[model samples]
Target: MTDTRRGSIQRLDNIAVVVDDFEAAKAFFGELGLELEGEATVAGDSVDRLIGLTGVRSDIAMMRTPDGHARLELTKYHSPSPLAGDPQAPPNVLGAHRVMFAVKDIDDIVERLRPHGAELLGEVVQHENSYRLCYLRGPAGILVALAEQLG
Candidate 1:
C-alpha cells in the first residue's frame, strides 16, 4: 500500500497590509523599529491577475523585525486606486484589524511614535506579571499592538 501523507507546511512568509500612502506607512512601521527589508513596484496583467484586481499597479515595501522571525508587506495601490473605509472602526468590527509585536520597551516605543501621529487606542496596561501592552493607531488606520514581557 502506498503512503498518503501530505508534506509539512512551511513557516509564514509574511503578512500583507494595503495602505493609501507608501512612504508614510513605511515610516510609521520604521518608527516602531522594524527594519526595512526591501521594496519594489509591481504592475501589468500578471500582477493584476495574481492579486485578483483589474489593472492593478502597486508599490510594495517589506519590513521585518530585528529578530527576523516575522515580516510585514506594505502595499500601496496606484492603479484602480484604493477605496475608503472607516478609519475609527473598533477591533471587533472584524477583518484583519491589527498586528501585534513583542517589544523590549513598549513605553519608549510609543513615545517615539507619538510625534508621527500614532495614537494609543487605550492606555498601556499591565496584565499581572505576564505582559504590558497597548495598541496604537498608525498611518492609514492600521492598528499596532506592542507587548513587553515581564521577567
Candidate 2:
C-alpha cells in the first residue's frame, strides 16, 4: 500500500514554549535529561515577519532528547516582551495541553525532578499491564507526562 501522508508533511521539528524565567526553564528541562543542543538569540526583520511581531528579540535554548527523535525549544523574549498567561492552567484548559515522554523509570524520573520544582498533578498509576504513567507541572507551569513500559 502507498503512504497517504508521504509528502503531505515532514517531521515535527520541535515544540516551542515561551517563558519568563529563561534560565530556570532551561535548567528544568536539562534536569529532565534533555541535552542542550545549542542556544542563540534571534532578532531582525525576518524573525519579526515570521512570528508576526515587531522588534522581536528572543533567546532560545534548543534541547534534544536522549534518543535524538525529539526536541523542545524554550524561548525567552527580550524585546516586545512576552505576554502573561495562566501559569497554573489545568489540563482541562484549551490549546496544547501537555508534552509526554517515554521514560525507562517513571518513579526515579519523578523523584529526580522534584528539586527542580516538578509538582505531580496526580500519583503515578499503571494502565493494565502495558505501562505506568504520571503528569507533572514543570518550570513555567509546563505540563509534562512520563510513561514507562511494563513487561
Candidate 3:
C-alpha cells in the first residue's frame, strides 16, 4: 500500500447509481462479473437528513468486483420519489459521467450485457496497443465503459 500523506484522502469506498429497477440493476452488474455483497433497505431520520430529503427510504444492492477492489451500489428509492435527470445524456454532458471497468474480453462482456438492455454508445475501439475500450448505456441509462488491456 502507498504511504498515506497528511490531509490526503484514503480511498474510494464505492460508487452509487440510482436505478428504477433494483433486480434488473443487480442482474446487469452480476452479468458483468460483480459479485453480490448484500441487499438492504435504508431509511430513518439520519439517512433523510444526510441526503437532504425527508422520509427517505430506498432499497440498495451492493456488488463488488471479483478482485474486491471496487464496489457499485445500486439504489431504488421508495419514499420521496427519486428526482428526474438525463441518464441518457451524451458523454460530453457534465456531472458524474461514467464508470469504467477493466475486462479480459471486451466482446464477450459486451455480448452478455446486451441481453440486459446494454446499448453501445460507440463501437469498441482500440487505443494504440494499450487497450480496447467502449462505452455503453446500461440500465437506468447509466453510462459504463469497458477496457480490455492488450499486451
Top candidate, metric TM-score: 3
The runs of at least 3 residues in candidate 1 whose Cα sits more than 4 Å from the true structure, single-residue gaps closed, are 1-8
Report the C-alpha lDDT of model 1 over 1-151, residue by residue, as the tens digit. Answer: 5556687546788988888878888888998889999999999988878879898888999999899999999989888889988887877786857999999888899999998779999899999999999988888888898999999
Q: After superposition, how far is residue 50 of candidate 1 from its true place, in Å?
A: 1.1
- Best lDDT goes to which candidate? 3
lDDT against the true structure, per candidate, is: 0.89, 0.91, 0.94
lDDT of 3 by residue, 85-146 (tens): 88778999868568999999999999999999999998999999999999999989899999
For candidate 2, write residues 35-102 as lDDT tens digits.
99999999999999999999999999999999999999999999997888888899998795688999
**Pairing residues by index, what is the TM-score of model 3?**
0.94
**TM per model?**
0.93, 0.94, 0.94
Number of clashes recorded per candidate: 0, 0, 0
Report clash pairs, candidate 2: none
In model 2, which regions exceed 4 Å deviation? 1-7
Error at 20, model 2, angstroms? 1.5
